[model samples]
Target: MSQMTSQTHAIAPEDADRAVIYGFVGRLLQAPPSAGDMDVLRALTADETEMGLALKSLSEAAQSANVNSLKDEYNALFIGLGRGELVPYGSFYLTGFLNEKPLAELRADMGVLGIARADTVKEPEDHIAALLQCMEGLITGAFGEPATLPIQEKFFTCHIASWAPHFFKDLTAQNTSAFYAAVGALGGVLVALETEAFGMAG
Candidate 1:
């Protein structure tokens, strides 16, 4: 239930789309989708693109799914004993380990960005969910900055583009992923869209 803030200009259509992507992905990773969330998604409409089709599928699945079922699936896919079907960590995805140099590097850059861990957060800074939250803040100036697209692009290219898409691909392919498979599809498509959009920038 975090509110993204923006100043200095109108919220572009694309920026809103980015927020939706980041927010949904962050929420999906942070917790299981509630019955209320499923209801909200079911009312959403999708256009005729690959990403839109994926979203349409997500909406359909959410409509048919209940909170308890999703909660159990979430536990299996992300919170199983010892480990889950997917680690969902940049350090794990990039280096085959947790708390590795990628995390160190992200921390150093976060320092530059004036980012800090909340006292309530016990998770690592390099967790994919946390990183996506950071991206949402960057794009929306939720952390009290200019919300420069270039800065957002740099942060994404450095911290996220390296492994998140592959992680999504893996998530999509995992047997335990029912609701999350649609999440993976949307995440992968959004990341690719961001990558291409950034590449088009001068």
Candidate 2:
């Protein structure tokens, strides 16, 4: 009997773009933007498209913001005394509670994808930032193989497709969100782009 073996494919240029976008969004959401992060953001520009406009807006916001102000906003919007204005977790968004079944299912899938939770991270596996990071890893073969389209689509449909765009739309409207409001707008575009690409691939 032949043994089942794994295959690794090099990521195409277009898929590489998805990985970069996912990674950027993941980092932007995972924590407050640092001065270095803001420095890079300050140089960006957007075009006529929604994503471009969002990016351009982000650059404008970043120009007005420093590390301290961005930190304060991050704390206010995502890390208040107990919790923030928004909970960026899939479980919470999908089921209105934390530590729920959605989180459990995501953990199971993450293990199968060889995506172990980082030791320093305390949040559940279904956090939006973590999920995006996972998607980036899958695309770049950080977990193992460059994940096949079916795998990517399966992960996206089960985890992201349901809740993230809703969260982004909400984020963009939050008064406490300035830099992150722009981040949210960009995230909305990203969710759309990934969904469309995945649909075509599938």
> Which residue pairs collide in model 1, if any?
none
Provide the lDDT at 25 for model 1.
83
lDDT of 1 by residue, 101-139 (tens): 999999898888877887778878887788888887777
Best by TM-score: 1
The weakest ten consecutive residues by lDDT in model 2 span: 1-10
The 10-residue segment of model 1 with minimum total lDDT is 1-10
Mind giving the per-residue lDDT tens digits that candidate 2 earns over 45-133? 65787667767888888888878887888888888999999999998998899999988998888878888887777878888888888
Instruction: For model 2, state the Cα shift of residue 51 in Å.
Output: 3.0
Q: TM-score for every candidate vs. truth? A: 0.92, 0.91
CA lDDT scores, all candidates in order: 0.83, 0.84
